[model samples]
Target: MSLRSYLVNLKQALSSRTFKTPYRIVTGNQSADMDSVVSAITFAYLTYSLKTPNEYIIPLIDIPREDFALRRDINKLLSYHNITEDLLYFVEDFDKFLDKSTSIDLSLVDHNGLQGVEINKGFDGGQVNVEAIIDHHADEGHFENANPRIIRTCGSNSTLVFHYFHDLAAGQEEFWESNKDVIELSLGPLLIDTSNMTQKVEDPDIKAFEFYKKVLASDTVNFTAQSNYNDFYKTLKTAKKDISGFSFADILRKDYKQFKFLHDDRVGFSSISKPLSWIANKFSIQDIKDDLSRTLKANQIELLVITASFTQKDTGIYTREFCYYYEGQNEKYAELYQLVWQQLELSTDLYRSEAISSLTNGVNDSGSHLKIYNQKKVTATRKQVVPIVKEVLEK
Candidate 1:
C-alpha cells in the first residue's frame, strides 16, 4: 500500500462517528523531532500495509497542532515530500476520544517510556494497552510489560523500524519494489539523527542504510544515496536551527519534555537550539523568567531546567548554557539546584570560569531562580544531563 492510500483510509476512519475496536495509535516523543516524527509515520504505514492484527492503525504526531509549526525543519521536509497536515493527526485530536471507553493500543517510537501519554489527563496505564516500543534512548522501565520492546543504542529509531519492515517483507520482491517512496521518507530521519552516518552510527544503522540502498537500486526510480544524504542532512539541520520569529514561550516548548520524579516532584526540561545570550537579546531576563514561571505553574512542575546551545555564525564555535528556576522559598528546588550545579561544575568536559561566581547574583537573590552558567566547553547534551539530574533527585 502506498502512503496516499493509507492516508485516505485513515481519514475515512477518523471521519466516521464510531471507531472500530482494537484501535492502535503509533506515536513518538513529545518533542516530535525529525527522528520521532518519521519513525512513527513510517512504522505506522508499514504496519498498516502489512495488514497487522489491528482494526485501525493511526499515526499520531504526539504534539498539539500549534506546536507543529515550531518544528520548522520537519515542516519543510513534510512539505517537500507532499505530506499534508490533513493526513496527520495531533495530540489535541486524540484527546477528544480519550473519554470514550475504547480499547486503544499504543506503539511508542523514538521513546520507550510512557512519558508521551502518561501526562495526559485521565490516563490509566492499565486501561490502554502498550503494544510495542522501538527506541534508542535510556529506558526508564515504564513499559516493562509491553511486548516486542525493541530498545538499543542505535543512531535513530527509524533504523530499527526500517529493518523490521525489511524482515517482514523478506522473500517478497514485489513488496520491496512498490515501497520506494516509503524507503525514501524513512531515510530522512536516519540521516538526520546519525548526522549523515557520521555521528552515533552503529551496525544496525549501517545495515539499514545498506538495505535501503539495495532496495532503491532494484526499484525503477533513480535515487542517489550520497546526494540524497547531503541534501537532506543540510536542509534538515538548517530547519532545526531556524527559530527566527518564534516567541519566547514557543521557543521553550519547542523541544520540551516533562518528567515526574521522587514522590510528587515534577520536573521539566526545555532544549533550545539558540544560546542564552541570543534569547536575552531578544527578550528581557524578566520576560524569560516569567515565561519559565508560567510553564511551571501550568504544568504543576516543581522545577524547570532550560539548556541552550549556540554556534557562532562566523567562527563556528559552540557554547552552552544551563538555567534552573522554581518558586520563591522552595527548599527542594534550592537543594536540587545546588546538586545539579555542583555535578556540572565538576565535569571535566565543561569549563567554568573562576572569575565568575558559581551562582548568578540577581536571579539567585531574587529567591525564585538559582543560577545560569556559560558552560564554556559545551560538551554535555540533554541525553547526559537528564541522568545526572535523575541521580541527584533519586538520592
Candidate 2:
C-alpha cells in the first residue's frame, strides 16, 4: 500500500480506542537515516496540527558523522520552520529508556522485516508494539500484526513519504512551503541510504536514468552543504580506520610462528594482524574496495582477501562493494554476480561471520582466490579495539 493509504488507516486506528494513549516514536540510531526521522516528524506534525495531546518522541540510536548529510536536511526544515533539539532525541542505549510509555513504532519504508527484526531484537524480543511500518524494502511478507504495514519496493522510502505529504498538502501553498523542509530532510537520507545500499530495480539501467532525473530536478539548495558530506564520511572513516596499522604477513610470523596451508586449493587465507584488525574495524567496505583495487593492481593479484573488524552492533552489514576479475571470461563475473542472491539467503549474523571467517580463518585453494571478505572477531583482548561500523552498501 502507498504511504498515503497507510497513513489514513493509521489515523483511523489511532482514533480507535486501541492506540488512544500518548506514545513515543523510536527510530534507527544511525545518522543519515532520515527516512524514519522524517516519518516520525510527519506524524508529529499531524498531531500538532490537529491539536492532539499526543507527545511525539523520536529517538536516535547511533552517533551520526560530523557532517551528516541528513542533519542539514533537518536543519533546512528547522530553518524554514521552528524545530528544536527537543523534537529529536539521540540515544546510545535503548534499554535505559524504553517502555509502553515509550511507544516504539517504526517507519521503515520497505517490503521486508529485516530491519524491524534487527531493531526489535535489540530490545530483547519484546513486542515493540510497532503500530505501523512504512518502507520500500522488498516485501518479504514478514512483520506480523503491525497495525498498518505499508511495504512497497519502490525507488526509495522518501518517494513513499513524498507521495503521502504531497497528498496531504493538496494545493496548500503555505503548507507546501513548510513541507518542503521535511522533504529536503527526507531526501538526503533517502539518497545516501539508497546509494549506500546499491539498490537496483528490475530495469536498473532505466531506473537509474529516471532516478538521476528526479535527483537533478530536485532543489539542490534544499540539500545539505557539500561540507556536510564530511560528517558522514568522517563517521564512516572513524568506523574503519585502523585496519592498515599492521601487515598480515608480520602477524603470521609473530603469532602463528609458521604459516601452513590448511588447503590452499584456490583461495589463500591470512590471519589479520592484531594491530591491523584493530585498525581495519575502522574502515568500511568502500574503503576496503578502494584499497583492494589499488593493492590488486599494484601486486597484480587477481584475487585478494581483506579482513576488517567491526563491533558486535554492526556485525552483519557489509560496508564495501568489491569488483572481481574472473580469469575465464567476462561472463564468469556475471555468473559470480548471481552468487549474491544465494549469499543473501544467509542470515545477517551467519553471513557476516562466515564471510569474515573465510577471510581470517584459513585458505583452501590458491588457484581460485575467492577474495573472501571477512570481519575480524573481537574478544576480550580486542575490547580496546574501538567499534567502527561503516554503513553497509545497501545494494
Candidate 3:
C-alpha cells in the first residue's frame, strides 16, 4: 500500500477513541536536515488534523553551533507563512532544558516523553529525543521504548517523512493536492543531503526523479526546488578533486622518493593544510564515514586521517576539514595528509571514530570497497599554472 494509506490506518488505530489534552509533539534538533523536518511536520499535521484544534504542540529542538545557512532557509520559509519562533523551541542544551521541566511525573507527560523520561536523564547528545527518535541510521537506538517506530536507512530521512505526509494528505480528498507542497519542501534538503547524486543510496536516481516531478508541481514559491541552489553549486565546485589535468601516480612516484610510511595501525590519523576543498563541497562527511563503515566491516580502519586545512577566502582565511580512512597497511595516508596540513599551517578540524562496521565490509560490484577515497593530486603543472594565472589575471 502507499505510505499515505498506512498513516491513515495507523492514526485510525491509535485514536479510534479518545478525549484528551493536545499532543505535544517534539522533534529533535534544528540542525536536522530536511528529512527530519519533514518527518516532524508530517506528524504534526496528522495528529492535529485527526484530532481537535488543540491536539498538538510541535516543538523543534535547536542545536548549537548551528548551520547559519540552513537556519536562514528555515526562518525564511517560516516567515513566509507568518509562523513565529514561539512555535519553535530553541533548546541549545537539551539536558538543561529537560531538567528545567517542572513536571517530573512520567504518568503526567504524554506518551512520547515517557520513554523520554529515562532517556533524558542519561542522554548524551548525538541525535536528540532518545524518547522520540525517528532516524534510520544503522544501530540507532532511538525510540526503543516507543511503539510503531519508523526508522529506515533510506537515502534521506526527509524522504520517509515525505511519504508519511503524502499518505496522510491523500486520505483527505481536499488535502491530496496540497500534499505535493510537503514533498517539495522536502526535496531541497534531500538534494543537499545526496549532493546531487554524487553520494547515492538505494534507488536514489529513481527517488530524485519522482520528487522532481512533484516539486515542479508545487506552486508554492518558497517551497520551490531551487531553495538551496547556490549552496549546491558551491558544494559541487568544491567537491571536485581537480585530478583531471594531472597524473597523481606519476607525481607521487617522483615526489615520494624520499617519503616514508610512519605508523601502520589498522588506522592512522592526520590533518592537511588547505583542507581537501572538494571533500566538504559535494559530500557530507557522514557519507564518507558511512561508506568507510561498510568497507572496513570492523568500522575501525587500519588507517584514518581527520585532516584540517586553511583556505584563503574573502574572510581573510578559514579552516576546511574532513576525515580520510583506509584499510590494509597504508600508514602514509596519515603522514602525508598531516604533512600537507602542517605545511600550510592553517587551522584544522579534527575527526575521530572507532566503528568496526566500516573496516571489514566487502567490496562492491566494482571490485572496490563500497566506498573509495580518491586522493590523487591535480597535475603538478597546475601549481606552475597558478603563478601564470595570477600574473595574467592580476596584470
Candidate 4:
C-alpha cells in the first residue's frame, strides 16, 4: 500500500478503534516541533520490517488534535503533501486510550525518553514494551534493552529518519521515485531545523543532505540548492511565526512544556515566534498577567518562562527575548527568581519599562512576578535553557 493511503487508513482505524493490539506506536517529543512530527511520520512509515503480524506500526503526533492547528508550519508542510489532519492520530488519542492498553510497544523518536507520558500496564497480564529508539538528542540513557537503539547528535532527527529510509532502500533502485512525497516530507524538517543548512549540520553529503538538496533542486533550476532550501525553510518559518490569528493561550500551548525541578518546583515554559514588544502592544499588562495567572493555575505551575524570537525587520538580525514570571508566590518564589538571575547566561540586559519594572521589583502586584531580558544569545534553545534552569532550581 502507498504510504499516503496507509496514513488515511491508519487515522480511520484509530478513530474507530478497529486495529488489533500489540501496537508499536512511534512518538516524537512532547514539544511537537517540526523535527519531532516529521521524524515520527517518516520513521514509522519506513520501519514496516519491524512490525510483526497483527502489530500496528503507528506514527503519533505528540500534540492534541485541537492544538494541531496552532502548529502552522507543520500544517503547511503536511498540507503540501495532501496529508490532512484527519489522516493522522494525535498524542491525545494515545494518552486517553492506547496508553493503558494491554498489548503495546513504543519507539522513541526525536527525544529519547517519555517526558509527559505515563505508560499504564493494562491488566496484570498485559504486555507493554519500549521496543526501539532512533533519536538525535543527548541520551537520557533509557530503554537499555530496546534493540537498534541508535542515538547520535545531528541538526535534526528527521535527518536521522532519512538515514533510516536510505539504509532500508539501499538496494532498491526505484525506491526514491516511488516514495517521492514521503521523501520530500522528511526533508522539510531537516531544512528548517538546520536553518536551510546554515547552522548546526556537517558533512552534508554523508548526511544525505547533499542528495536531498539535489532532489529539491530538481524541482526547479531557477535557484541554487541553498537558495531553494532557504526559500522552503523560510516558508515554514513564516507560517509558524504568523500568530495573528491565535489567542494568547493558544500561542503558549503551541510550543509549551512543563518542567519539574528537585525542589518540587513546577515551572511552565513557552517559546513563541513573535517579538515580545509586539505582544506587549497587542495586549494590556493586566490581560497578560491574567492569562499567565490562569495558565499557572490550570497547570499547577510555580512560574512561567515566556520567550519570544523573531527577525529584526529593518536590521535583518535574529532576535530573542526571555522573560521570567510567576503568579502569587512572592516569599518562597523569590529564591527561585534569584537563582535563575544568577545562573542565567543569556547575556541580556533587562528591557526596562515602568510596567515591566513593577513586576520585576514586586512593586505593583503581589499576584505576579516578571523580568524581561533582551537575550543576546540568539540560538540558546529550550534544550540548552532547560538544563541550566534545572540545575540551579535543584540547588
Candidate 5:
C-alpha cells in the first residue's frame, strides 16, 4: 500500500469500533526529533502491514500535536512526504485510550525508557504493556522484559528499522512495491542523524544503508532516483536549525530533558541550536533569567541548564555555551552549582578556554541567579555533560 492509503486506513482504524483490543502504540522519545518521529511512524506501519489478530498499530509521536511546529525539520520532511497532521497521533491523544476498557501495548522506538509519562505526564491511569523496543541509544534497562528488545549504539533508530524491512523484503518483491514510501521516507532520518553518513556511522547503519540502496535499485517507484543523501542532509540540517516562529520558551522546550537529581530535585537541561550571543542579543539577561524561572516553576524543577551551539558566521567556527540558573535561596542548588564550577575549572580538556561566570561584568557576583559560561575549547554534548552533573549531584 502507498503511504496515503496506509494513513487513510490508520485514520479509519482509529475511529472505527472494529479496532479492538491489543492496541499497539509505537512511540518515540519525548524530544521527538526527526529520527524518533520517523522511526515510530515507519515501524508502526511495518507492524501494521504484518498481520496480527486484533492488533492495531498506531504511531504515537511523544509530544503534543501543536509542538510539532517547533521542529521545522520534522515539518519539512512530513510535508515532503505528504504526511498530514490528521494521520498522526500525539502524546495527548493517549488519554482517550487510557479511559477506554482496552488493553494497550507499547512498542518504543528511538529511545529505551519510559519517556512519555516521565517527561510530559501524558499517559495517566493507563496500564500499558511494553511489547518491544527498537533503539540506538545506550540502554537504560528500563524495558528489559520487553520482547525483541533491539538496541545498538548506531547513528539512528531509523537505520535499525530499515534493517527489519530490508530483511523482510528479501525474496518478497511485493513488500517493496507495496511500501515504497516507507522505504524512501526512512532514508531521510538515517542520513540526517548520521550527518550524511559521515559522523557516528556504525556498522549496523552502514549495513542498513547498503541494504536500502539495493532495495531502491530494484524499486520501480522511481522515488529514490530523485534524491541523494548529501542534498537531503543539507536541507534537513538547515531546517533543524531554523527557529523562526518559535518563542524563547518554545526553543528551549523543543529539545529539553528533565532528570531526577540529588535529594529528588528535578533538573532540566535544554539544548538550543543557536549560540548564546544570539540569544543574548534577542533577549535581555534579565528576561532570560525570568524565562528560566518561569520554566522551573511550571515544571517544578530546582535547577535549569541551557546549552547552546552555533557556528561563527564570519569564520565558520563552531562554539558552545552553558548557562546555569536557579533560585538563589536553595542550598542544594548552590552546592550543585559550586560542584559543577569546581569540576569545569579543574578539567583542562573540557574547559581549555576561560570560563565566564558572569551575566554582567563586575556588576553581579557568583551568587547571582543566572550564570553564563563560554565553555571555550569544550564542545561536549548533553550526553557528556549530563553524567558529569549527575556525578556531582550524587557526591
Candidate 6:
C-alpha cells in the first residue's frame, strides 16, 4: 500500500457506507506547522499498521485542505515525495463525506489542541472522545485518561513518533516499501526543527536521526535518500522562511493563535519567521497596519499581536519584535493603548528596544495606533506574554 494510495483510499472511504463508528481522528495542532502535521501523519500511519479489527485511525490535517497550499514547506515535502494534494483529508472532510453521525475519538499530537464541535465547523456536532496524546510541549494536565499520553520536552514531536514506532518500522521490509514516502518526508521537520541535529538537539531526536540514516543505508530499501544532510536541512529551512510570495494577510494566519480575553474580547497573535523591521520596510508600516486591521475585523478579533522572529540576513544575529494593533477609532483607542503599554512595560518578561525604552518611541499614535518594539528578552515567548495580556484586560 503506497502511502499516497492509502491516503486516497482513506479520503474516498470517508464518503462511503464504511464510514463507521468511533472515528479515531489523529490530528495535530490547529496552528499547524511541519513538525505538528508530520507527527500526526506518522502516528496515524503507525497506528493503522498495528490496529485491531475495525479500528480506523485517520490522520486529519488540522488545517483546511483548501489552505494547504499556503504552507510552502509542506508543499515542497509533498512534491519531494510525489504525493498529491488531493490524497489527504482535512478537518472539513468529515462533514463533507460522512453520511451518518458518529462519535469521534481524537488522538492528539504535537500540541494538546482539542478540536471538538464548538471549534471545528466540519464536525457536525459529534461527541468527541480524546483517546491518545503524543506531544513535545509541556503538559497542561488535561485528558487524564488519555492512553499512551507521552509528553516530554523534545526538540520536535516528529522524533517522538518515529521513536515510538522505530522497532516495528526497522524490522518490517514491507512497511518501508509502502510507507517510505511519508516516513521519509517526516525527516524534513525533524531536521529543520533541530537545526540539522546541531542546535536545540535532543538525545531522542539525535537517535531517530541516526536510526533513519542507517535505515536508508540498507540495501533493500528503495527510497531516494538525500546526498547531503546540510542541503536537505537548508532546503526545508529556506522553504519555511521564504515569505516572498505571501501578502501581509497570508502571513498573519500562517502561524497564528487566537484567544478570548475579558468581555469576550478576541485577541490573536501571529508568529512570523521574519523580523519586524524587514516586514515593515518592505510592506510599509501603514499598509501593514491597514491590512492587519481589516483582517482583525473580519475575524471578529479586537486586537492582534504580531511577534516577528528571525536572524538578521546581514548580521546573522537572531532577534524578535513585539508588534501590536487594536482595531477601532484612533481617538478612543489611544486611551487604552497607553494603559496596555503600561502593563507591558511593568512586566519584567518584556521591554522596549534599546533604542526607545525611555519614551513611547516606536508608537505610531495615528489611526492604526500601532507599536513595534524590539523585544529585549529574546527568549520570552507567548507562553510568557499571554498571562500578562489576560492581566492587562482585567485592569
TM-score, one value per model: 0.88, 0.42, 0.44, 0.86, 0.86, 0.82
Pitting candidate 3 against candidate 5, the one with the higher lDDT is: 5
Candidate 4 lDDT over 1-395, as tens digits, reads 55677787666766675666666688888778888888888777777632342235788876678888888899998887778887777856664555545567888888876655333323223455778888887787778987768888888888777776677568763556566666678777877877777788856324577666556555432234446566777888888777876777777888987766778888788988776666665666667767777878866788788877778786887877777677665665566545655444454454434434544443236666666777776667777677767777777
Give me candidate 4's TM-score against the actual structure: 0.86
Q: Which residues of candidate 3, in runs, are more than 4 Å off?
A: 1-23, 29-38, 50-54, 64-86, 92-119, 122-132, 168-170, 179-181, 204-212, 215-218, 221-395
List candidate 5 segments past 4 Å from native: 51-54, 101-103, 118-126, 168-170, 218-227, 337-368, 376-379
- Model 1 C-alpha lDDT per residue in residues 1-395, reported as the tens digit of each score: 56766777788877786776556788888788888888888888888777564356788887778789899888877775578888888887665545454457888898886664433442464556777898899887777777668888898889988877777778776776787777777778888878788988999999888877777664334346544668767887888888888778889889988777766667888999775556656776667667877888876788888887777676787777777778778666676656876656533232233212332343455556745666543567777787888788877
User: Could you tell me how far off, in angstroms, the CA of residue 298 lies in candidate 5 after the best superposition?
Assistant: 3.2
- In candidate 1, where is summed lDDT lowest over 10 consecutive residues? 347-356
Once fitted onto the true fold, the runs of candidate 1 whose alpha carbons sit more than 4 angstroms away are 51-54, 116-122, 217-226, 313-315, 341-367, 376-379
Candidate closest to the true structure, highest lDDT: 1
Q: What is the C-alpha local distance difference test score of candidate 5?
A: 0.72
**Candidate 3 C-alpha lDDT tens digits along 7-37:** 3443453344452322244563222334444
Q: Residue-pair clashes per candidate, as listed?
A: 0, 44, 35, 0, 0, 0
1-395: candidate 2 lDDT, tens digit per residue: 22233334545554455653344453532322345455555544543343233443343423222223224444444443345443344433333334433535443433234232235454456535555556654444556676456666554555554555445546654543434444444544454445433453323323433433344344444344333444543443333232334433322211110111223212111223232333235455345434544444433333332333333344553333222322223333334334442332212333345444433333223322233322223321111111111101111
Q: After superposition, how far is residue 148 of candidate 5 from its true place, in Å?
A: 1.0
Error of 3 at 109 (Å): 20
**Candidate 2 stretches greater than 4 Å from native:** 1-22, 29-59, 62-87, 91-93, 99-127, 144-147, 169-173, 190-395
C-alpha-based local distance difference test score of model 4: 0.70
Q: Looking at candidate 5, what is the lDDT of residue 39? A: 91
Q: Tell me how far the alpha carbon of residue 314 in candidate 5 is from the true structure, in angstroms, after superposition.
A: 3.5
What overall lDDT, based on C-alpha atoms, would model 3 receive against the true structure? 0.38
| Candidate 6 lDDT over residue span 1-395, tens digit each | 55565567677776687776766678887667888778877787677765443345687776667668778888887777566777676757755433354567778898764642333444335566778898887676778898878888788889888777765456675665445565577778888777888766889988877766755654422334546667877887888877777888888878766766656667777888876555655675456756777878856777787777777676777776676777447443344445545444423232223433322233345454566666656665664565566566656
Task: In model 2, state the lDDT of residue 131.
Answer: 56
